[model samples]
Target chain A: MDRTIRVLVGKPGLDGHDRGAKVIARSFRDAGMEVIYSGLHRTPEELARMAVEEDVDVVACSILSGAHNTLLPRVVECLKKEKGTEELDVLVLAGGIIPAEDVEFLKANGVDEVFGPGTNTQDIVEYTKTNLKR
Target chain B: MFSGYPGGMVLYLHNQIIQGLCERKRAGLARAVTLVENGSEHARHILEEAYRLRGHSKVIGITGSPGVGKSTLVDSLIGAIRERGDSVGVIAVDPSSPFTGGAILGDRVRVRSRTTDNEVFFRSLASRGYLGGLSRHTGDIITLFDAFGFDYVLVETVGTGQSEVDIMRYAHSVLVVMAPGLGDDIQAIKAGILEIGDVFCVNKADHPDADRAVAVLEAMLGLNRQWQWKPPVVKTVASQGKGVVELLGKIDEHLEFLKQNGLLEERVSRSYIAALEDNIRRDTVDRILTEARLDGTLDLVLTQLSQGKTYPAAVAKQLIGKYLCAEESDNQ
Candidate 1:
């Protein structure tokens, strides 16, 4: 098997609903991967540090408070600030109730994919694998 | 000189207890979790041992709007799991007092009567303005519980904001709670929430217009046809324990479906990577704030932006300095 992939999952800002994030985290655990969940209300700076310290391969963020347009990019910016874009080896993904148009915008800004409402667990798993494999 | 043999024996005994915890020994699990929460030296040793067994349990988070009765649903499921002879662990993420930073944890308080049950290991965490409806040490705590051998671990959060969504990133499955008469606007207002839920619960189904609300949600789901698992709609009167059994079944089915498709491994890998990055970012910030003392510069920048002397983006550009990616890419 390849090295155990690590991830830093966080809820940034004031949004408190974590049911979705927790479920995803558990799913990952059941799949036999290492996951470090930053318990709620994290700043982007804190999240970036978490990614680096944990040596995570990806940073999957779930934002439902509708701050993705602002917060998502800020998270990407924080990660990239240390070095060139190459320093950002971690795949930054977002989930939660994002509008269709906004998803495209976020992807343009740096989000790998924005899984919206009703995206199946299997699809997410497949997408994640395909992306990570690359 | 100290007796090395006795010390070694004591350490051996500690390891045995920790190993027992990882094997799901009830008393051992309790003791180990307490040790970690208390930040005891013994806890550190226990954690170090448990860390080797870390990536096993699936952490499912349940969150929704307040008064949607999320706790009651969790309670019902706990009871259901017990009926099936499975031990269940729960971490209730309660609201923190914005003023005092203490947590109310009303959910745990309501379930106090069940705390004495040998099969149940429950903890209440204070959000403490942690923003994501979880404790800063939540990851460690979850690992502690998992190592302790709880078959199913559930986290219930105060259903609002990015904090609740953050919990999903940590969990294997997410259940979004909603109720009728909350109005169409709430549904629309929280459209982002609708997108994240793997399972949607229209709680308080006994209330008026419940079916209509379900209809509306069904329509919404229909519009979005690109999901991995068709987000199922489960209606319940959580306060009364109605539909609890069906809901539990659905949860199990979802779990099985994920396992069957080999999606479980992929999801876990993504979550692991995400978690690693989050940990790195958090540590880096702590180091900067504590060691570099960048507060002064941050304050200066904020002041400058507020005074209209510079745009926020421009300030960010200056604060980060000239090693912009385009400029630095050539050197690397």
Candidate 2:
């Protein structure tokens, strides 16, 4: 079955800055990916639930609220708990105002990649296209 | 704590999808819908496997022209349905831009109050070139939604187009929405549109002339004396959530009427026949057309017709005889 890449762009925690998430969502839309933007102030549980329901190839969880350490891992854990082998192998990635020092910690907790500020949407789109497990 | 099977692994996307559907997983339902909407092969498998799991849900079709408050009415209706303690699944179809094929499916956003509720499932489908204002995949998605165990599945059509009325073929109850201050063209088109409504709603009832619009609808219904069930006219200020409960009550009365008259099964059979006939066309005529194009038979026919040497009826007979009858003979 032919499938387009599906991604869930989520903002977990109280970060009201949805500009970056919305921008990435538009980029993904332009790139022909089916993107479900799980708008602002989403908790880890909500993000996980939406990610599974969307069966997204990637969950690009964006956090600008500095709660990445507490929330991102929870999103990853919730995803790991609810999804089955029959669903898309969701890849979790983080973006938006994530401090440089926190990148490795997030990666250690199962975030596939981290996009600090200045990373172009094209780069993420390229990464997504190449990395999607068809 | 790690309950979600890690997302990465070679999952038979088809098996993975239907399994989630069987388990009633929201993610599975959502993904399978997209697969079907895009005409993916997995869609067929999912729908086929999931068919037996359907039929328990009632389908309600909501339709009207753009800005007629269909979405708002649906939002209110979902609340009303939930108040009666049943789960609801909504399918809202929006028009894709003719130029870009992009649509802002913000209907789900308008119904945002129900988004976080576990009892409500919302899906938006872009018409994606379907002239009828309902997606071609609408039927298949309804089947999946039914299988997922929603007690009531609501389908909202792509605004007001004559073809949008085609969607009524799949619903147990169809609400034709109209609002006050519509242009004369809409009134004229009502002759064609009025035939399909199980119930009529004049939404945005706060507007001036709301009663006049309702009177006009009542007058139109009066012109047709043959309706076994006279469609009820419900007035609703959808934005303010007025009269939504009364509309739901009307729906109950209609459903009860259908049940008492044994027409409930008839509506279900009507939808089944529609789905069956669609498949028959897809499997037979569509495939044959494709083959004819590929094998030059269509071009030959076109050339023949252009020269006035032959016509479509004769050519169709020849092709059918060549392919269908020959296949039958070969099997014998």
Highest lDDT model number:
2
Q: What lDDT score is found at residue A106 in candidate 1?
A: 87
* CAPRI rating of model 1: incorrect
Kindly list the per-residue Cα lDDT of model 2 for residues A27-111, writing each as its tens digit. Answer: 8777766566666777777667666554567899888889999999888888877664433377788998888898899988888
Which CAPRI level is candidate 2? incorrect
The superposed Cα distance between candidate 2 and the true structure at residue B119, in angstroms, equals 3.1
lDDT of 1 by residue, A8-65 (tens): 5667777999888877766655554455576677778666654543445668898899
Model 1 alpha-carbon miss at residue B142, Å: 2.0
Query: After TM-score superposition, what is the CA distance of residue B84 in candidate 2 from its true location, in Å?
Result: 2.1
Per-residue lDDT of candidate 2, residues B141-255 (tens digit): 8999999999999999988755457776789888888898885435634555667888899999998889889888888788778989999999999988899999988877888
Q: Ten consecutive residues with minimal summed lDDT in candidate 2 chain A?
A: A80-89
Name the lDDT of candidate 2. Answer: 0.79
Give the alpha carbon lDDT tens digit for every residue of B222-306 in model 1: 8876877987999988767788788877877777788998877776665566556666666545544443244476677667778
